[model samples]
Target: MPPPALTRLSVDELVGMAGVNPWELHDRLMVGRPEQIDELANSFHRAASRVAEGDGVFGEARSCFQGAYSAQSGGDTINASPEVTKTANDFQLGASQLDTISRSLDEVAHALTTAQKTTGEYVGSLNAALSQLDAMAEAIGPGSGANEQQYNQIRAEGAGVVGSAGDLVTGVVTSYQSTLQDHMALAQANRWHSGSARRGGDPAATIPGNGTDPATVKQWWEGLSATDKQRLIDEHPDRIGNLNGVPIADRSAANELSVDRDIHRVDDVAAAHHVPSDEVLAHPELYGLDASAVTRYRNANHVLDARKTDANGGRNRTYVMAYDPLAFGGKGRAAVTIGDPDQADNIAVVVPGTGNHVNKGWSGAKDSISLYEQANKADPDHKTAVVSWMGYDAPDSPTDPRMLTPATARASGAALADDVNSLWATHDGSPQHVTVIGHSYGSTTVADAAAANQMHATDVALIGCPGTDLAHNAGDFHLDGGHVYVGDASTDPVGMLSSSPLGMPGISVAGVDGPGLGDADPAGVNYGAQRFKAEASDASPGSFVTFADHSQYYKPGSESLYNLSTIAAGHGDSLGDQGMLAVHRPSVAPVSVPNPLGGILGPDRINLPNPLDTGIGKLADPELLRGGVTDNHNH
Candidate 1:
């Protein structure tokens, strides 16, 4: 028996079927007559297949019909024959099963159609959401995050501005203080001398000469009573030298007293006496000296020697060949000279590194001259001079420790320092500031010298320094007001690792605080201080002592070189920034974004009429719709 047609039959429809009880149909069709129900399902499926193989909407409908037919195969209509009442009941069961399956198929078809519609709507929503996001992104521009490049750039610029401002302020204050101090010192000196002179009984007595013409004043002074003259001499010990030739105080005072009245101008007197204006104004005792005393003093303080010994045992030259009588017959003779020998300025000395000798290979003489030339070039305007002291016998290479020990090197440096000081004293000059430029082992020598107070250079600059165990802190090295500058190019490997265990272990020639000199920190180090960077182009090639090292003490155009020159010339404390920002500023304004999501959403998503195109929820609109469709239709 064929099963009953079940298409269009809902659960209620099945219950309303002719001569059918809902409970009985469920029990009989679902549980019995399976064969009869299968036959009816097969026939229905064949019909549906023919329809499904067609096109368009009809094909979809056919697929739905096929599902209905398959359901009917499980209906209870198999044994509908008069021979058995049980078979008849089974046939009824098959018909009931077919109806139930048909209804299920119809429901499924409806769901699929609905899902397809939903998917189309979802696609539209997704497109709208993407459009909204794009608009927002456009409005925001880009730098909303804290890590954005624009934000970082702005911060850096701000910091630079602040730092520059601070530096300017500091410079101004320092200059003001320096000027005030100079004025005070000058006032004090004048007051002390003027008061003493005024207190003396006779103005002429205080003046050290009569009011007569030059010749008469000399005769009157010569004719003074021995007791009166002796009393005057006792009062001014420096004035006693006037009876002979030596103006006891200094050349400036002596020159002033001799020619000032005759020339009627202090400047002329200064010029004639070869004395500085300050010296003349500060001290009056050295004015007017007799020839004999002057000659005696000149001989006693004369620096240059008339005779000299050749290094190779030959005739000696005037300026170059004078032998050091103090170190007679020694292995070497050290000659020291000061440039711009003036008391009001600063000083510097450039020490060459390895391969420094007197012989043809690496002569200390030649290296010293080269360094002097470089220093002059570094700062032509500064009143600074370079002292080229080749005290130690620098090695061709790092061969032996005995050849270079701090103690031994220090002894030689002390002698050299003594000579420098003596020269300064003899010339009536003193260095207000001093800097030492030491390259490689020369740095070692400088450190030792400084430790022993030999070279009282204001700042110590160590280039390609192997090691100096000086105290880490400025106080430790007794240079509280002084600075230590270390310059090591990033490419210089030796500077990166060299150290001394005996002295300041954590200090390096560079400015860092470590086992070696510490890392390069520019804030604390300036002027003759270590500058950690590449070698300046203007630096002399020999400034770098090591063969593989090209570290120069003061390159012509290098920062280190300029700093040394400025400090040595007494301008180190007052140099302002040289429009460095103009030189370093970028050529173009950088493209930047301030906010990431400010533009597109009108700053408020829910308020927009088209929420899908302008809201936070719009972010997932596309994916959300697609998901809804899949959930509705996949089953």
Candidate 2:
């Protein structure tokens, strides 16, 4: 109830009032049309029901997705399910509030209409009494005793009528006020606002676009209110899920939303084509399913399955740092972290080499977990985060000719640099000790990143590397107060392509001069990289080296893994004598060797160790099993 429309009046003035004012009462109550409120309530209810339908669809789709991962078990569902459920609840809450408002309006409207009618009846009685008084005054003349008495009676009756009408109006006003107050209190308690209301358009539209500096994005994200942040996540998750500058937890949440949406998108396509969701991924051709849809489905499931694995083993939490299931012509790209990179004291970004994609998530997940465990073991006092980044479109096969060129690495290097720079931007406190580890062709990619794309890292390790075409020496990496490290097994054919001390004619021509894939061997004496022991002891006597050595660097309990873990944990100096390898630089000049069977120009044997006896010893040739000796080992 608002204050009276008119000021306090004398009793005579009250009697003189013409009629009750229902318009003023309605205006003060602020009740809109009841029909319109009902419509709004219906809209809310429909939205709530739609959300429930979406929830069911995701549940069904998740079942099909989980089937792909486990034989008979189900994988973890989307982490966004709880948030989705809350969103549905919010919709239902809106409907409930709308209903209450509509009913309250109806009640107030009825109360005011009834009060107006009752007040009119009282006014009618006062009008009739005044008529009678006027007649009596006319009949009895000016000073008549009867006229005076009649006049007094009519005045008293009119006053009574006014009092009754006023009291009735007051009662209606009080009831309306009580109802309004209760509604307001409920709204305040629930923190209720119009769910569909927004001052502007979607908040996500205001976010900076891709390729914006991650630091700039971080600042923009921080400036938003919590409500706006949640609104953006709820409405437009894909915009920021894979964005580099966002916090890990928020990115995880946003990626989860995108994962759920991806599942729904794929399932929707399958449904449109009358293909069963469970069978759509296996027989994508049956429904004319696009490759990207299938890829998105598989990648989404991979993320869920990884989380399930961690949950079952009580391992460190897994966060999806990057998830783009539809990028790169269906090859897709993704990155997952074994620990929170922002909070960890040491962080390692592990880039996979050739033959990797989002579909092959198990390999990356295993590597990430293994590296995380090793890093934790190396420096137990400090926490380490390892991110397995399969964010590039890696060549499908190791033998692919693309491996002989820096084109692919160059194309993908900027993305790697941006990701690394983003880590520094989003770190929690003082800058973390960041290490970038690249295996096989991934090393070349890392080289390109640092050399041309402005990658910023503290330390870099390249293992089983073929060559670094862009980076001719360790200094080309431009590490911040840290050294580049190389781990090449003597027998590893791929590693030999870059670090072979023999400098064999055909090998050099094919690896360096011909395709020019890697002209700069990081393990060479002039390259200035710390050499680490990654050689395996199982080389055959007759054969130069087995291919098995190529993939053994990351094996647990091995010297190479130990050294890598130590460096990743920020304890590179603690590798001691056993882990470090001495530099090996064979003379570049060829020598005429008088072979028993034929004459050939071989590498200078004086500087090259016997591959069979010493296994191409990292130090100057050790006293060989055949009695040969060399001195002057350099690390």
Candidate 3:
């Protein structure tokens, strides 16, 4: 049904309406207690945030309780996981409804305040016009001459003025009514008691499962109505925040909510344990929090802080591309981008190596920012984004047994492939020039993703790599441009793992993939990858060069960093002119030396010299080791 229009007021009626004190009404609406509505709205938002945090706490408690239950019971015999998950979902829905109410209140208050101010102005104008008309009528009283005609014309114009004022008043009234109706409907739709009904039961059931294909998930998400999408974001951010195929901006908004909830959860847990929130990190066990909870707190705060203040003196837009505080057995997973990846013409995903977790993830932020700056410098006309993707569970220590096999890397590779492909699925416009860079063990993971999982990328760079696992040659990656770049420094111990006879044994043991053992190096002469010069220090080893050189590929003002920047910015053709290519060494096969008594030696011993050795015996200046650039591991 059509809505009724506002009544048109006559001149005399407008005069009556304008009798109220315009100044008083203006003061009341603009500067008085009505202004406090903003504060009230803020309070409701804060409460909603607190409720969301409580949901996170419930999730953590569920995890802890499930662990205890599993230890006591033979298995998950009680189905505690589902029950806890549902409870958490319910709490999240409540929080969403609270946020909805807050927004509605804010909208109504703003609209009414604006209308009251406009109405006051209209009333003042109308009263002045009517008063002037009265004065002119009195000035030409009881005359039938030119003065009488002028008075009549003035009265007619005055009526027109009154009619215009009536129209203006009508607009304000109509706007006020519309605002009230819209907000009232929203409030009713998100009522506390009937949230489930308003939301149509579980929102999770309406969306694609987390394990769905990235392209399929993207299609499903795009197919949703705008209203449905926003409802999910408000009510079930946990589901879409880290979902593979969602758009970057929407994921960022959802993850930001997730971060806030995590911070709130930490505080609540601290309060429950009678400890200060700051002390939660010092003694997480006191709150029944896993070690990962501390890291989660740190990671969440890191993202929040980045939003408030610029880091490394750069004002690049920051976004939480992915966040999962309880993922990967509580080690956690997260990805922070220096610029919006979806908007950038060039994008680089920097995957770190061992000992990186959510707690120490901020270290990679510095590298990401630096790489972003350099990549921009390389191609000023095109926009670039760098992502520090700590999205996989890495070995906590170099000697950890998980490094002995390709299982972790393979699994992580699949995840990485999905993440990269998700970016391709959700990016804006034409195909982006995407580069995936990995260091040390992360290189192995990247290789697995590209070779076995069909990761979508234009270029791939591996630095300080121990091995490539199933990816033996550049062709194995199947990159868009067939460009597989390698940045292996001669003094890097880890990078030389495949070439060094001492380090090759362990890699060979861990190189098993299907029925065949994979080669241990992508930078070897026979590997067919395009090598770039990455010797940040002297080619010979020093006190710090052994392990420290492994981390220098991304260092500022270095040749390797420059070459990487060029590749990331899709300007790789200039690398040759810039003298960034490493010297090519011919592949050397192991030669057999026949012994005079061949039976005594079992067979002829085989040996070959590796051109990419770390030259452990040849030490560089100690001063260089002491005062030179330190690795990120130290930082």
Candidate 4:
């Protein structure tokens, strides 16, 4: 694998061969360890490859280290380390920290390798000179006209070759010995020198924080030992799953591992009790007897299904952000990311609304894949991460009283805010843009969260919105008016009834304030939002086309999907300034509703055009009519 070992020679002979009196301690050593140096170099290269690819956190840092070695190593100078630490959020701190040590060795290796190459070239030049002199001596025969000149040249060149070779050999020996010692000393000082101790850290008690602060959580994650990480996943998967700021890759790994453990746990229990799992699957509350265990098994299967393999047989990674069956009094909350958010250049989080449940998969994995593919098509160069974030107990049937108010949105808003904030916190600068897209009632959730928490996002999109409460205009969101986009279609009766125009039926029925009681509808012209085409056509500006209905905005071929992808790719500016599907701004201006309760202000207006005569009332249930908008219209 390497060049044949250099022939060994005694120290005195080596000194005499070099003819250098300046050399001191080198004259005393009898043995050489050139092979040890070669072996150590191999080890360094092998470790570098693993550290570079094993975890996403370390990969960026590794690249920076290699870049430094290449650019400055040749000059025999070391500058300050750039903040490559930003890339590696999971660099464990302790005696076993190897990232810095590895980098240090890399720098030394560059210097040593350069020195060795230069000395070898010197030795080669000497050998070449001696060969040339021997050839000239043979050609000349004896003393001729130019024979004397040739002989002098030959003697001088031969002597020079001998002297140069000896000096080069001495230099190689001295340099290699010192470099080897430096490398060995540094490795020994770091506990990570040995493979066994490389993964060491403190116990679980030392785990920092409650896993909220992204920076702090990353630090804590890095400080943990190998055993600690595994134990956290096994013991507190819910905490691990919902913990924001942890890398999605790690979360996916932890979740999958927990899923496996959960399956085994259920199987072990079922086997011990002679419980028929077939019967358990059929009716968990009845035949299974242990409803809690059945819930665990079901959640485990949900994760297993999510672990489906791609065409290339690679497991599609899924981050289980939140998974708790007993959350919000049994309604539960779940969030999953279809791709790695930390490494992507663009990230979009989709929140689903009405009739969402774990059984129905609030935001199904299939749905996530479709969105992911759409984003890829939108911007092929930048890696896009799409999140199916159903991190709340969403409202069920429209008949439910809770659906009429903003209570569900208010409670879930806090959780949604935390989820989005975590992304910004853990992100290592790749994703320059982040967008939050909410559909149907989910739109309302996004609005409520953004308004309450001042959510950090580059863009906020509301699709098929059903009254985003209290948002009188797009500017009411955390982002500016230009950053909020809305898509709604006229054929969608849900969109029509819910859009809070002057004296709108849906708004009045909520028992809030005016007809436009809840929030200004994005399609109502006055909401000050950008709404472009959504009807799956390549028509010009004046061409007529039907917009998609409430449930069809996300369909593959729909115009809404195209527009959404465009916006997600940060091309919203291309559409210019035009609200989609709204031919004219609301003709009748909104009149502020009375706020007799002092600071309880809202955009409640009177003397407005009632939407009842427009037949929007016929589509609504009687309960909606009974709530207060039946016949109270001023014609």
For lDDT, the strongest prediction is: 3
Q: Comparing 2 and 3 by TM-score, which wins? A: 3
Ranking by TM-score: 3, 2, 4, 1
Q: List the residue pairs that clash in candidate 4.
A: 531-580, 536-559, 593-604
What Cα-based lDDT does every candidate model obtain? 0.36, 0.63, 0.66, 0.55
Q: Name the best candidate (by TM-score).
A: 3
Residue lDDT tens for model 4, 128-205: 444445666667767676887776665554454454444434544454454445445545543332222332432433
Residues 1-635, candidate 2, lDDT per residue (tens digit)?
22122222233454456244432443454444545544654564465466556656766766665566565545344423544443443444444444434443444344345434433433343344344444544565557687677656645654554444344344344443544444444334333344343224455444554444566567668867899888877777776787778898888888888888778877886778786887887777777666667778888887776555552384578788888887655667788888899999999999888888877663556666667887888788889998889888776786553553455675567578879989999999766799999988788899989997789999999987887866878889999998898887666767655533333221232122422346566765667888776655444323355677787777766667777888899978665555355444442432323322111112223123234312243332221111111121111
Give me the runs in candidate 4 sitting further than 4 Å from their true place.
1-202, 208-211, 267-276, 281-289, 306-316, 480-482, 499-517, 535-548, 576-635
Q: Quick one: how many clashes does candidate 2 have?
A: 0
Which candidate, 1 or 2, would have the higher TM-score against the true structure? Answer: 2
RMSD of 3: 31.7
Better of 3 and 4 by TM-score: 3
* TM-score between model 1 and native: 0.34
lDDT of 4: 0.55
Each model's TM-score?
A: 0.34, 0.59, 0.59, 0.56
- What is candidate 2's CA lDDT for residue 344? 92
Model 3: lDDT equals: 0.66
